[model samples]
Target chain A: EPEVTQTPSHQVTQMGQEVILRCVPISNHLYFYWYRQILGQKVEFLVSFYNNEISEKSEIFDDQFSVERPDGSNFTLKIRSTKLEDSAMYFCASSERDYGYEQYFGPGTRLTVT
Target chain B: AQTVTQSQPEMSVQEAETVTLSCTYDTSESNYYLFWYKQPPSRQMILVIRQEAYKQQNATENRFSVNFQKAAKSFSLKISDSQLGDTAMYFCAFVASNTGNQFYFGTGTSLTVIP
Candidate 1:
């Protein structure tokens, strides 16, 4: 079965540096999303992207966070400046339709900021 | 806003025994979707089962089944004849049909199936 895939399974960056987490969603998927989980916390929604624009975002998705589908296949989340709290497992998910469909998740990218 | 809650922080089941994980949600929307996801030690999020709020019949996938109580706003997962491999962290999630499809996940329940 086709699955969502993310790059840089593990990323380490300086506290003030910028970081980009990339994902390649299923080819036919129309909606994409980004979520994060602190080491022992529940997964939190970051943002949702569709039609090259942000459809929805959570309070945690502040100015520092941005998502882009630069190409037909690549969707990326960029943190303008990483904070220690930003260190978590970032996951990318996609669904074929907008409603009632299950979102398929990627293995996730572990971001570590020191 | 939608919220999912899994009250059990941890649970254990003996191999070949049956186990049930409880979940509850707060949502006003009449139409929505509930999901159960499994994350093993590998940390990959896997979809274990799903239930549509409009459906009265429960959803089952082999040994994995759900007890969905729409009126009570409860969705629970039951694992029958549990195996050692069933050890993992399980999360309950919700998504409203009219919303932007953002998933609301619970804190998760850590289940260990003992051999």
Candidate 2:
């Protein structure tokens, strides 16, 4: 089965530094999303993208966060400046259609800010 | 806004036994999807099963099955013939059909299958 793939399974960056987490969603998927989970916490929604534009976002997806579909398959989340609280497991997910709410999640990228 | 709730924080079952993880959600949308995802030690979120809100009959996949009660807003997962590999944190998620598929997940229930 085709699955979402994320680069840099783990990322370590200095506080205040910019970092970008890259993901390659399944080729035929039309909707993409980003979510994060703090240690032992519930996964929180960050943002959703369709047609190369954001559809909805959460409060946590503030000024520092931005998502881009640089190419047909690549969907990336960029953090302008890393904060200690930004350290968490970031997951990229995709679905074949906006109506098929069943999203397939990637293995996830662990972002650690020092 | 929708909220998913998994009241059980932790649960355990003996190997080869059965276990049930509870989940409930508050949503006004009539058309939606509910899912149970398992996060193993690798922390990879794996889809265990899914249930459509409109379906009256429950959904079953192998040893995994769901008991979905639309009127009660309840969706629970039952794992039969549980094995050690079933140990993981299970999360209940909800997504509206028309929206962009942004999920609202529950706090999660840590399930351990002891041998």
Best by lDDT: 1
On residues A10-95, what C-alpha lDDT tens digit does candidate 1 reach at each position? Answer: 99999999999999999999999999999989899899998999999999999999999998999999999999999999999998
lDDT (tens digit, per residue) of candidate 1 on B16-77: 99999999999999989999999998767889998988899999999999999988999999
Q: Could you give the CAPRI-style class of model 1?
A: medium
Clash pairs, candidate 2, are none
Poorly placed runs, candidate 1 (over 4 Å): none
In angstroms, give how far residue B33 of model 1 lies from its true place: 0.7
DockQ of 2: 0.70
For candidate 2, the TM-score of chain A alone relative to the native chain A: 0.97
TM-score to true structure, per model: 0.96, 0.93
Each candidate's B-chain TM-score, in sequence, is: 0.97, 0.96
Q: Lowest-lDDT window of 10 residues in candidate 1 chain B?
A: B95-104
lDDT tens per residue, model 2, B1-115: 7889999999999999999999999988899989999989875688899888788999999999998989999999999999999999999998886554679899999999999
lDDT per model, in order? 0.94, 0.92
Stretches off by above 4 angstroms in model 2 are B97-99
